[model samples]
Target chain A: MMHHHLILRVVTKMLVGTIILFAFYVQFHGDFSPGGGFQAGVIMAVAFILYGIVFGLNKAEEVFPPWLVHKLAAFGVLVYAGTGVVSLLLGYNFLDYNAFNPGHPSHGQHWGIFAVELGVGITVTGVMVAIYYAFAGRPPPINDEDW
Target chain B: MVETIINIILFTMLVLTALAIVRIDSLFAAVMLSGVFSLLSALLFVTLDAVDVAFTEAAVGAGISTVLMLMTIALTSRTQKKATRSGMVPFVVVAVTGGALFYGTLDMPNLGDPNAPAQLHVAPEYLAGSIKDIDVPNVVTSVLASYRGYDTLGETAVVFTAGIGVLLLLSGLGRRRRKDEEGDA
Candidate 1:
């Protein structure tokens, strides 16, 4: 649908890689920085959404299928809850990180935080992309000239 | 002093953008202006030392939402219907709410007051305990993930549920429904 927009396509192709790289940075380095899973996930979703906009929704869906996106959205929640369940099984309070590393509780905290943040990131990315797909797949009621 | 000046500039821009959004009849133009409004709010958040919030606002508010709204505009009407009724009711409600909010602020602490009740409350202990327990350089992460992990878990579930809800409502484009309808027919 956006085939004639060569400039947008070229610019998006260039920016997508950098956007993905920055999203990863925001995701992993969040513990020491301002960003975390939520912001990183949105940023990550932006990369794919931009690609979908410049190219076409079908190509974007092919790269990341809608079924996979739905599964991912749920899987992220499982990853988050599973961490707490692990702590519970290990004889610590739910979500208590001390269960991970007996000798160093702080390291345990780090691991637990990382796991949950990853879960949050995955879920957010899935949801955002899925919404984008749903919206873009629909037939437009009017032409560009209507606006 | 410099921060205050920057804030004033951002706030002015924000008001101007909001006024434009309200007055504009073209939904597309309104959507674009709202994106600018979000960007300005993100900048204001930065001045307030809330970079994490600013980041989210910039990404979700300015970037993702703009795309989403544009898609919505495509699916719906391009121009908004003019309101047939007078705007007096909404104006009175807004004025009353704003006045009440201004009154409520009179009892609140000033910006960054050292002796504010919130500063003396659990915030101190949370800060101290976070350093000793979590040892994460970013206290916000530790607080959200470790200290208030249950809340974070709940929030994730909410996000998950929201995605499910949207899928249920807007997945009309999906072929599964059509195939099911055909089979039933």
Candidate 2:
């Protein structure tokens, strides 16, 4: 039953890489484009979730273990909060980007935005994947034929 | 002219999809129709020149949420149970709430109105200052990450809290598996 759909498995294999690449593009190119951390993060999570759906949950879990997913989720929040704390330590207002590069405030803003967006991306990806795992891990009460 | 046509088509599709979802007895069909609804709304967002929102709606709404709903259906029943009670009271409540909401929209500014309160506020400064201060071409990103960093931070925290809550609730499965193994040993 697991390997029943050859087309789905093969197609997912081809699509996964492209999805991840697009997610990265959306993440880094966000400053110049319509996407940002949130959209990018969702796209990234979709890749993993797609993999899980096609290849079965066990294989996907092997790729990204639950423990790691939980850690990554918390770590993203820490990274975001840490950036603000750093600015505070530097005697600037909370989340003041000017503190990152004092001579060129715009450069500092760029760096600060990049870092915080990265944090947002990471957290969102982790949270989404974790939630998917939570839902998919439970055994369905009904059989496949019922649907 | 083209934009108006596109908007009308998309909105019509959205209304039809919503009606189909309401009329459908099959849970799976409803889920699929909701995904269609999301895709239509994403197209609407694109026509409105909010590509980021469109991208998010397409990905999260059409993609992830559909998958989540399907998973939920797997866990539960595929067909919705027939309502034993009449839906009149609920219908009246919905109509009243929707009417009030529609009434509220009368006070809202027309689309793309320059004199709108939203456009008259700090948005102009953000648009003007973003390139000079943040040096980002995407003013939305600059505004979200720099100008309103705290608000985004709060949003992130909210996502974090929700994830943790779901994990706490559903994480019992792993413990149960471990206990089963111990019992076997």
Candidate 3:
């Protein structure tokens, strides 16, 4: 596998960085654009998946260990639920952003949306990469030439 | 006139791609064609002024799903098996389902009708109030992340559950257990 095509490796190296940068741009600029947490997360995962394909699953796992990925998935849900719980404790309805800033409700709404979207982005990136790992980690039943 | 031409061309391509997918026995070609189908629909969505939906369809449908399908093919088989019997029963079932769906669409409101029930309902308030309440330029973002936060949270949970299910099914838990037992011995 290490002796695989150099051109593929070089192209993947150049593309991976650009892909991750675009993912972040999509994640943050989503407030003003067509993308959001879901699109950004998938793009982020694609970076890792492409790396896994070109380098090898073991090398990709070294960069983003599986245990960390699992924890990140759970952590995203916790972050989202925690935002709602905070608003509830502040004497507002569940997920009421105004509770965060009583003097300036719209500001609070902005902050709340940002937090929740960030949580969504993290969870999506985690789950996508996890699924890819699950599929690619398996030993292929047939040889490559068989395809 | 331009919009109509674009719509017709995109839909024509979509139908042709779908037919090609059906005709091909090679699963790899089918997967690639399905990605093309997704891209065509994304273009259609863009023409309808639904940029967000188009972005999602292109990313998920054309990008990730294609990769996933390719991985699945690697795990399974490249070619589809030939049917041993006539396709009459499946054809009848598909025809009946398609007819029922088409019949259901007859009651749908016409596209872009301002007075349609869907447009008249919560949409008006969302459009009017989003800027004042959320101060966000993108109403869709404000609605998804702020006003309808609970629904988005539910969707995230659903994604989480699906990931856990796949991990349990395909992560080779039994193989790890056997390795642990061997170390103990």
lDDT of 1 by residue, A57-125 (tens): 998999889999888998999999999999999999999998999799999988999999999999999
How many angstroms is residue A114 displaced in model 3 relative to the true structure, after the best TM-score fit? 0.6
Residue-level lDDT for A1 in candidate 1: 74
Model with the higher lDDT, candidate 1 or 2: 2
Report model 3's TM-score to 2 decimal places.
0.97
Q: After superposition, how far is residue A101 of candidate 1 from its true place, in Å?
A: 0.6
1 or 3, greater by TM-score: 3
Number of the top DockQ candidate:
1
Query: For candidate 1, lDDT tens digit of each residue in B35-83?
Result: 9999999999999888888998999899989999999988888899989
> lDDT score, residue B80, model 3?
100
C-alpha positional error of residue A72 in candidate 2 after TM-score superposition, expressed in Å: 0.7
The sequence of per-residue lDDT tens digits that candidate 3 reaches over residues B114-154 is 99999998999999989888888888898899878999999
Instruction: Find the 10 residues in a row with the least total lDDT in model 1 chain A.
Output: A138-147
Better of 1 and 2 by DockQ: 1
**How much does each candidate deviate at the interface, measured as C-alpha RMSD after superposition?**
0.9, 0.9, 0.9
Q: Is the docking of candidate 3 incorrect, acceptable, medium or high quality?
A: high
The TM-score measured for candidate 1 stands at 0.95
- What is the C-alpha lDDT profile of model 2 across B77-163, one tens digit per residue? 889999999999999999999999999999999999999999989999999999988899999899999999999999999999999
Between prediction 1 and prediction 3, the one with superior lDDT is: 3
Off by over 4 Å in 2: B173-185
Off by over 4 Å in 1: A144-147, B173-185
